[model samples]
Target: DLSINGMWTERLEDSCEKPDEHPTPLTKQQLEQLVRSLILVEQSQELRILAPEIKVLQEDLQLKKANVYRSIPYSRFGSNRDAHCYRKAFPYLLAFKVSCQEWGQVLLRRKEWDAVLEHSLMAWLYTSELPQWDTASHNALREQCYGVLAAHILTALQHCSLEPSRGHELLRRLKMAQLQSQSIVPCIQELQRILGWAQHLDCDL
Candidate 1:
């Protein structure tokens, strides 16, 4: 139990920090600017980050409107205010998709590929709750996912082949090469922990 607890604690330390993001309160002027800029601006890579953020912002904004309309007595705003807000947010949301396509070249760049892949996967996985990005984006999305998996598999073999000192050296190289990205080892360890828990429950069953 002591050893198990130690491993779990270490895993928590290794996991990525949750991003600190807040809703972008678009002013009337900002909204106009965004609409105008959408065409000529060329916002591909930015959309990779913005698409997810906008989804969350829209949801929050919808809830806020709902709270006001539902709570205000004798208000003409009606219970459907939230739905109306969502309609307004739709064009901007679709713009985000076009933006992603626009930035395809940036995403495909060798230096940014790893980060783009990881970011896109997170966007797709969380789409239901927020981004609402279309399933059509899955081709590039799956390619990046498979690329990461393949890289990890290769790393796993290299890790096993190395002496202890050489293994550490190889890991250092990966961290540098991958822009200080978190490693496959900790991710694998977390998977093992989850499987271990499932097995224990199965035995109990």
Candidate 2:
């Protein structure tokens, strides 16, 4: 039996009997090609070019009974040492990174500071789906997401004034994510500085 995204095809009995006994993993060349296709798709905004590769990869993962976003385990003394465990899901994460960056660039270019901040916060919220392993690679990706969030917050402060209620709501969301206080201190300080200056100007009026 072969399944690709819920549509299953029945094979000969002999093939069906041992579907899981020996699943064929994607080759390194195939993986690289898929990643290249993903990059091209993102760059050109052409989904059709990558559709076939996505189907093949999806079928391969389905046969292996693997989740596309599954958390890969790593160990120094085991078969899954390092990010080799990320074999099947590397493209997915790369696609995510690319998409987030592109969105940030577009929003920044438009000077849509509030939209950029919201988009960055949304990306940070999605980081929970990433592998939680303490590996350097995984931590770096998480930090990148955090950096996007923090950078946008500061940028938005510079370009537009945030209402006190909206600012508090943003802080609430960050707290919900359990982000480190230091990571957001610069944003807080900048917001305070702007609000204080606004108050002083109002008093002069």
Candidate 3:
């Protein structure tokens, strides 16, 4: 965790030193990598370095939106709410996916069984949320996070990997990731398949 924090802090330093035409817009891959770093820091249950970084991201995104909406009449008309949503969603999504992945990490560290299954479900929900966004980066990140979390959940759950919270606690975490992706793990798919089979003959999750 110290290593993760140190690396990101260095990346954050490099990012600050660079003077691009605009703050270098974070690419899908970069944002995902950021989330991965956030996850590592969180799982270690150590320092709180991510908050300021998330603020930087939010401020940068807001700046971009202000610039974008100014020239684009259609956006000003509020007809492109999806565009607005997509712009802001990734931070929240990254936070969400990483946090869940962190939870799975903690459980794996603890060797908790049923709770791990629950955390696995939480990861599945995160991935499923990914496709709802129309952005191409989101689509790709969805697939990327989906694949990673699937393997993660499977390995952890093999058998501890699994599932979140009610609204307030969740909103707090979003504040933590500066706000934050989603896709199914096979066990979730398999669980659904089994549930479907059970409904065909009387069983459930």
Candidate 4:
């Protein structure tokens, strides 16, 4: 079924000439179906086989402009609403993000930077989707995740400066997060100073 979804994307891209003529929007059920498919696909140990499916889902997500991160669809889980509801309710989308983060840590432990960046970026995509921006716990998690994100960019910058492709990729994402997230992790100041060619760290001044 995901393969069918993949083929549909290829067909849609080839056939549609105008924005208005693009494929119909996926129904709520289809959205959930596709999101669930990706979550399961990424969980597999056989990433070699599942990689294409994840790529298809990512492409489909971009084409649709479908944001599973922001809105929580409560009707999807009527059987045990209370169980899923934490201080703020956790949606299927949050589960998808958390799943990505889990796999990302696994990749990080193996020092697979590209793979780590892919999943870490996916997980970072949803950090802005948390319901309460000013809440204490949310603020803490946001800072922590952004810190890790900066480390990813800085590490890439340190290693990939000569071949700057992936470093630039991480740099772009870092700027986006710096703008989008209301606060930055403190250590990111050092990164900014380096980028600015400053001679001294903030502590020295």
Local accuracy by lDDT, each model: 0.35, 0.52, 0.45, 0.44
- Residue-wise lDDT of candidate 4 within 127-198, one digit each (tens)? 554444333553454555555554554454343322345444554565566665534333244344545524
**Per-candidate TM-score against the hidden true structure:** 0.27, 0.55, 0.44, 0.44
Top of the candidates by lDDT = 2
Arranged by TM-score, best first? 2, 4, 3, 1
lDDT, residue 114, candidate 2: 73
- Residues 93-141 of candidate 3 have per-residue lDDT tens digits of 5545555456555555666554554455444444453435444554565
Q: Number of clashing residue pairs in every model?
A: 1, 0, 21, 0
Off by over 4 Å in 4: 1-88, 91-97, 133-162, 165-169, 182-205
Residues 29-100, model 1: lDDT tens digits: 554354334422323324455333434433423442233233323436554324444434433333333333
By summed lDDT, the worst window of 10 consecutive residues in model 2 runs over 7-16
TM-score: model 1 vs. ground truth: 0.27
- Please identify which of the two predictions, 2 or 3, would achieve the higher TM-score against the true structure: 2
Residue runs of model 1 more than 4 Å from their true location after superposition: 1-83, 109-111, 131-205
